[model samples]
Target: MKPRISMITLGVANMAKAIDFYQNGLGFPRHGEGEQVAFFNLNGSWLGLYPKDALAEDAMVDSNASGFNAFSLAHNVGSEAEVEQVIQQAINAGATVTKTPRPTDWGGYSGYFKDPDGHLWEVAHNPHFWIGPEDTPK
Candidate 1:
């Protein structure tokens, strides 16, 4: 099978609030119109937001389950400075800093934050890894 994720769908409790946080706070460009869902384009894939109950129904799961979802979304930048900058930006956008930017054991710098809905995100600068499209190895 091909190794690629077309989108990451976040089950948010409040659609409008989530949309505002991602669109206005983090400066993620949202496309389409409606109150039920929102879509934001990322570097290669997409970020989707939908009502938690609705998403759970679609997945045939109970929405009452909580706590860490056992996964985190990561945003990799080009340098240590960018890691700091991105983390600060997320914090300004109503994110809670779970970990302040610092040197990592992986020989890079990284940090983490929780979005308004408590979805964890990691912001990192891996000097040895080129994550962005322009620098990604062929």
Candidate 2:
């Protein structure tokens, strides 16, 4: 199997709301105009949004799950300042700020936010690591 993630599909409670949050609020460039689902082109992968119930049905799981899903999606940036900026952007885009950006015990800076559907996202900056070329400051 390839050691790369091609896409991350999020089951959103509201398609339109999720689309606006990612496309307009977080500035993810949307890829297509499909109403049933929305796709965004990321730096190296893709982010997909589909209705929660439909996604659960497709996966043959119950859709009534709530609370933490026990995982988080991370966005690594080039600097501590960038981490804060991204977190604030998410907040302004209607996300709930779960943790304000701060220096971490692991020697990095990071923060957390939850999207409209309660999907947790971490915006972070690690001095020792860089995830991708897009994380480089221009």
lDDT by residue for model 2 (50-128), tens:
9999999999999999877999999999899899899989999999999999999999999999999999999999998
Candidate 1 regions off by >4 Å?
none
- Backbone clash total for model 2 is 0
- State every prediction's TM-score relative to the real structure: 0.96, 0.94
User: Model 1 clash pairs?
Assistant: none
Q: Highest TM-score: which candidate? A: 1
The window of 10 residues in a row where model 2 has the poorest summed lDDT is 129-138
Please provide the root mean square deviation of candidate 2 (C-alpha atoms, Å). 2.7
Error of 1 at 117 (Å): 0.5
Candidate 2 TM-score to native? 0.94
